[model samples]
Target: MGIDGVVFGCLTPNNWLDEEALDRLIEAAEGLQITFHMAFDQIPTTQQFEAIDWLSEHGIHRILTHGGPRNTAINENLEQLRKLVNYANQRLTILPGGGVTVDNAEELAKQINVNEVHGTKIISLPEENND
Candidate 1:
């Protein structure tokens, strides 16, 4: 893999993250040649912005977020999350994951206005396993 960067997936605990954990994650990421893409749980818009700002201060350029749970798909929360990402587009690359699927990936890509969308299984299992 010619990937020059990496994404660090950390679950936001209880809708809130411990500063100690964040600090440690940042420290760990700094040792690598990859850009850290932090994946957070369902956090408020304000907090989400704060997280992005904090990561930026630490030199993290990519941010990935869990797009809510599966139930939220029908409630428009996913769309709302996308809006938040778009709002913060100037600061970093806001990539959404978790519930992303091929069916709604195009919609998410369009709504978020991001060229890339990340997912664990975006490619079929066989393709992923092949490498």
Candidate 2:
């Protein structure tokens, strides 16, 4: 296989990164770009900055996040997302997702100062129910 990258994440029951599990994934994904998925949002907000430092030190390439509780809309979470992008400081990519749509993607990225965004509606509408 010629896959270029992988997205994965793991958290302990207490809402911390399960470094043991992540180590396994990292080893398996060696030589490929690795993105820690939205599970980043599951960690306690107070601990998130530390998590970013940890993930960056471990060579994670990106973080996909909604910037807050998943139930909230992405627009409502822009401030937090902005903080995350700023804190990342290019140490790793902070990808804002959830409720992101093509219609709003440009402004959203500009607001958060991120170069990328992610969501089901990021590019175009589904033809039918393809999702």
Best model per TM-score: 2
Candidate 1, residues 1-131: lDDT per residue as tens digits?
55455556444555654556667777766655434443454555557767667666766666676555445552265665676576666676766766677667777777767776777656644445654
lDDT of 2 by residue, 1-131 (tens): 58999999999999999999999999899999999999999999899999999999999999999999999989999888998999999999999988999899999999989888888877875578765
Q: Estimate each model's TM-score.
A: 0.65, 0.93
Roughly what TM-score does model 2 have, to 2 decimal places? 0.93
The regions of model 1 sitting more than 4 angstroms off are 1-3, 9-14, 31-39, 124-131
Q: How close is candidate 1 to the true structure, as a TM-score?
A: 0.65
For candidate 2, the C-alpha RMSD (Å) to the true structure equals 3.4
Q: What is the C-alpha lDDT of each candidate?
A: 0.62, 0.93
> In candidate 2, how many Å is residue 86 off?
0.7
Model 1: colliding residue pairs: none
Candidate maximizing lDDT: 2
